[model samples]
Target chain A: MAEPARGAYRELVRAQIRSQSQYRASFAMDAALTSCVSVLEILAILVLFRVTPSLGGFSVREAVLIAALCEFAFQIADLAVGNIERIAEYVRTGRMDTVLVRPLSPLGQLLAGDFPLRKAGRVVQGLALYAAALVYAGIDWTPARALLAVTAPVAAGALFAAAFVAGATVAFFWIDSGEFANAFTYGGRTFGTYPQTIYPAWMRVLFGYGFAGYQPALALLGRPDPLGTPAWVAWCTPLAAAAAWVGAVLMWRTGVRHYRSTGS
Target chain B: MPSAAACPRPGPEPESGSDFGSDTRSDTEPDSGSDKNTRSAPDARPAPIPFRDSARAFAALAGAGFRRHSTYRQATVAGVFTNIVFGIMLCAVYVDVAGASGRPGGYTTAQLVSYVWVGQGLLSVVCIWAWKELAERIRSGDVAADLLRPVDPLAAYAAADLGRAGYAVLTRLLAPLAFGLLFYSMYLPQRAVTYPMFAVSVAAATLVSFAGRYLVNLSGFWLLDIRGPISFWMLILGPLCGGYFPLRFLPEWAQWLVWCATPFPSVFQVPLDIAVERTSSGVAAATVLLQIAWAALLFQACARVQRRAVTRLVVQGG
Candidate 1:
């Protein structure tokens, strides 16, 4: 968090961007492909609506609102900290030793390393979906609702970032943990895209609260909880996000302390 | 190293890089094999290998492939866990869709549930994505060793992929399906023939999927850096092959096009339709035949492309 360390992180990101941009055509193609994947995900939701009028008691417009909010949060978090998923590789190849001996914070180095500038494509797509959903959601814009709308995705992104960081800690204990990590990191995003009531009771309690996007989305659209939870739950996203961050930070520190070199 | 254009050899054996100059200068060097006597013209290629030998080789390679996949116990467990999680999430959404509409896409609630679980099981068996072994080999110049082998690289890889699919059936395919059966009301096939037919359809689908991946990998021969194509392929295959949702959700013309003109539907949609018994027996049989046709067409393309790729093969790394 010091000024010099922050400058070092920015320089690390700038180097990655320079190397990535050197191959202009490949970078463009990757960005386009990333954008296409995001489009396909949104299309998957819309296609479900094509067959039925509503999904889990939400009309197509309302579902899109949930999906866009969840997707936007995921993309933001993914762009910010997704590279930590490569910890498994670093540990396997003994590159974690190199990462550890660096002057800056190890987590900061990992976050800044190999930053995927191309993933900005998904962020662009998410924003487009969010903008379109806002127009079609037909919400009455009070001053408070307007403020909540802007901050809601950032809170959800914070929670998702926590999920990614927490997921990366699995690499310290287990090699080849990518699949298990994806089950929650990606799975949690998919869980949040729909109304929480659709999931089984346990799934809703576990992944539903962990995602922390559905509640804010419901509040934004002015829809009552079909499961009849308290209305105050809608305002608890920031609280949930903070709690998740604290837990994730604790887990990450524990994982780093427990890390051992593969010692090839 | 001698230039390949100057030598123009008919077969893949390269004599381990010794005496490169003399080898390229001499054009009349006879091929040292029994098939040389059967050759009528000097420029003619050798006779094809006997069918029994090819089949035995295929079986051995497939066995090796199966064993290789079985070694990854941790990865298998992690993958199974992931598949079951996705299956549960997707099943919840699909149940809502099927329940809302009396029989959306002509599938009952039980049948739709069956479709979802079966599709999850088949996702790994068909292996529509996550196959980059061939491309990596190609990039690393290891594919040159494949050409030196007696068997065709296309058929050899296809057999190995079948073995991998066989392993996937036991772990990746069954675990998630059992999970679905536990929590949901799954539809049982009413007719006995559907079981055998479904098995055959799945095998054909695995072959079709392998051929598709082979073609994608072969692109590395020309493009050198195939990450772009692989990424695009991964993005499209999920939706187009019905991994995310059924292609039946598409319009009628699009469905016809997918089934007839493209090989994507034969990879996942055909086997799924057969498993759910959504189509009648006659139609189910027809879909299996369609899968076979696609597999044959794709493998033929793989063979031709492999032949071409090897002749112009430029190994990237030493």
Candidate 2:
């Protein structure tokens, strides 16, 4: 028999989506605001850009492409999984009680809620910038390469969700604040949005432990190894995060056990 | 959490919510079955720090305050990371603007890009968001509390500020620095003399920043809406201080205006200058002296405000 909780979560998603649809103007306004503002932040950089400029070793235009690539990758992280992160709150605040008592698995129900319909605005801006980069950077695009490029983001998106899940799981036991986990999840995104070569050593290690910081978009962008990371190392970057994702989940389950004792 | 300041700064009074402890105490408080569950999760959970009551009890209270705050930590973490991404996006724009073809003041496109990363990293925690611990005391009509205390109220405020500053710098400043180092080809200052100078400059900035913020916090004692004053301060301060972008990139007149008009230059420009040794040794000493002057003046202003508030209280109610 199907669990009622799963159905309820579906309803929650449906309701949120419908509510967002009803306030169409508000949704559009917020969307437009975010997109426009984010773009302006980028435009500021463009104002400072001089033509045919060399940045470090990379051309100004190439840096733009890397920037946009990371932006697109970052947006993928931001827009894709609005629900999973909130589930930690559900678990922490005793809200999970309602979900658990119902027939559905709390995780299953959680994964179903929080449809990020509005982030389309963010996506539009990111893609627009990305397209501009394509024009400016003048990269050769092919069917096979395009397919790989697309997969890079999708896989990266999945990795982002996984990181959230794992990070949130830590919050379950600690049961106080989940900001540190956010540092890894959102922090990684911010760090990743740029070419992964501008920061210092400790930060690089945060990503390098498993290509934890650099891999997802790196895979999509063919891994711009500003640090001259080995080809094999670059290839393994996304997988490094993938490992963290799985590790985080296992950690979450263990934390849940702690929560059951402490929080329940 | 009680600041005793009535209208210290222009912010909302937050008295409605109860303390976080009242929500989850397992003593006489209702023990939902969930309490038992916590007992069994040994390795998975941290033992609760027992609350105590001493002058040192404050240390525990701060710990508790942190625990109470952990619930929001997840949200804060998300906020910071999102901020970092925004920073990255901002850096990209700057990188794009500075091309191999153009270098400003001998800084190439790449160095400028790296510079934004540093600036963003700095702003995550260290900025002139003012509070008036002194002003707060005055506004609260607790100038009486100051007269009665054994130690100076100023010293008391400094202790508390240092404690909280310790917490904020970890989450806000250090975390992003970690991200920057890992992700970018960071430009580090090479000189040893610059290191000590940078430290001294940072210390000066901190003192000045503390004085300004403490003054702002004090406004809460007098104003129902501190946001107005805060926003006004931020609106002018954000750009003038070289917080939003590098001072070098702002137009020359604007840059000169910031340097001459406000305390903004001291907070940011001096530190960077010292880091790069753009200022000669004598000039650096002069800069440090200026910071000491500002700090003394602000501290004096705060004490004067306190004395007036205290005198008013004595006349009316004391």
Candidate 3:
């Protein structure tokens, strides 16, 4: 059983890679489409700088730096995962039954598909934006800062992946149409592109409100927060993501258990 | 012995119209649709009316499309929430950059704000820059049945899709248009005549976008796998078409590059510009000409290709 489980994981990964390669042109195009979307969003920030230089003490370069960070974090988080959206479909079609019958944990199977390798395109474009921020904005990037920059994307990706997994896990129970749910998953990343400082106070309070809510912002521009932010906000993006992911895992297990008992 | 020599090769044309020649994927649904909609006296059928003659049909379609869109009231509001929140943040940044007083290239901060809001909201419905399903239908050859429909295939798809697009306009599009006006204090036309003109321009944009998608989708007929074309075009033109952001915000070079390549801004920018009346009369006339030209060129090409497809199949008796 254990051997077969290992074999299945390997086979699924191999198959996914092969499938992606088979549709190389399609994969490339999807990557390019996503890259263009991110670039368009970035252009919006560029337009902001055109009329004047300073945006409340933030220069055009600085704003772009911030936008770049947001884009980077968003690309990493949003693009890296695809399988998360299939939860309802899997549940509805009894494909989940195959996972249940398998020796390996279904969570592992879910995770395997959830990580979209095609997301590499957005990730590259995002990294270019972040790099531009460093060069064009002339940031003081010491080795420590560079290492932190590396972690920023990984952390953001985890955070975004966690949000998607949580959403997918929730859909396992209701089995309702997940159409509107995309507005949450993709929309959150799109909404997060701008600095959170621009958002309304009530909206700020509703979601992350803190620097943690704006990790892409922080990892980008390190938003100058008066509420004792700089000390730990940078670390919180990954921590919050980890916590969210853990919570999502717990939820998924609960949903699975419910499925087992309900036998639906 | 060569494997080819061992077994006789099947010709491209099938022996019978009823039977789809042997194909792989033994599990997929076979015989999806009949080859022909009109078996005998095919010319007895009325020719498909040109798009110009379809005004009554167009208006009826639009009206029905509007009602169809309004049906998903909940989905509409949820979409509004995301658009408005993002609009505020984006507006804040641009306004600050525009400086203390309103005005950049003759665009006031308020006007620009409103433009961004309406432009952003209308963008979702006005331009489907990254249409995925068209390629899907073509790749799977489900378009075979779509071809047999009595009405024009592209028009039928447009009629149905336009409803959703119209819904995007009413709920998603209007929310931001109104939000920009009320909350953001956006610019409005002085004479109020521009409102109707804006409506006209917007309707034209929707149809053009639909026509553009049909052309893109028609690629699937010739190319069994259309991922290359669809993906490539989507990557290049999706953002250029004003889906993610406005072209007014793009760099001068990008603006010029995108303007000529696909007339993406004509979908969202030109209409919004008409409302503000920034375009000179000459440019406005030119813009209108370009939009019509693109719509006509793409629409005609689709018809020609579809006709050729039918002729080939019938002659080959496949």
Best by TM-score, which number? 1
The per-model DockQ list reads 0.35, 0.07, 0.26
Candidate 3 segments whose C-alpha is farther than 4 A from its true place: A1-6, A31-44, A91-107, A141-143, A169-184, A209-230, A250-264, B1-74, B100-102, B127-129, B178-182, B225-228, B242-245, B250-257, B276-286, B308-318
Q: Write the per-residue lDDT of candidate 1 for residues B3-25, one digit (tens) a residue.
A: 00001111111111212112222
- Per-model TM-score, in order, reads 0.89, 0.53, 0.77
- Candidate 2, after superposition: displacement of residue B163 in Å? 6.6
Q: What are the chain A TM-scores for all the models, listed individually?
A: 0.96, 0.77, 0.80
**Error of model 3, residue B126, in angstroms:** 1.9
Q: Which scores higher on lDDT, 1 or 3?
A: 1
Question: Could you arrange the candidates by TM-score from highest to lowest?
Answer: 1, 3, 2
Candidate 3 yields a Cα-based lDDT of 0.59
lDDT of 2 by residue, B178-219 (tens): 676787666666666767876677667666666666566555
Q: Give the TM-score of candidate 3.
A: 0.77
Global CA lDDT computed for model 2: 0.53
Q: What clash pairs does model 3 have?
A: none
Residue B190 of model 1 has an lDDT of 94
- First chain TM-score, candidate 3: 0.80
lDDT string for model 3 (B124-171, tens) is: 576444454555655555556556544555665576567667778767
Task: Extract clashing residue pairs from model 1.
Answer: none
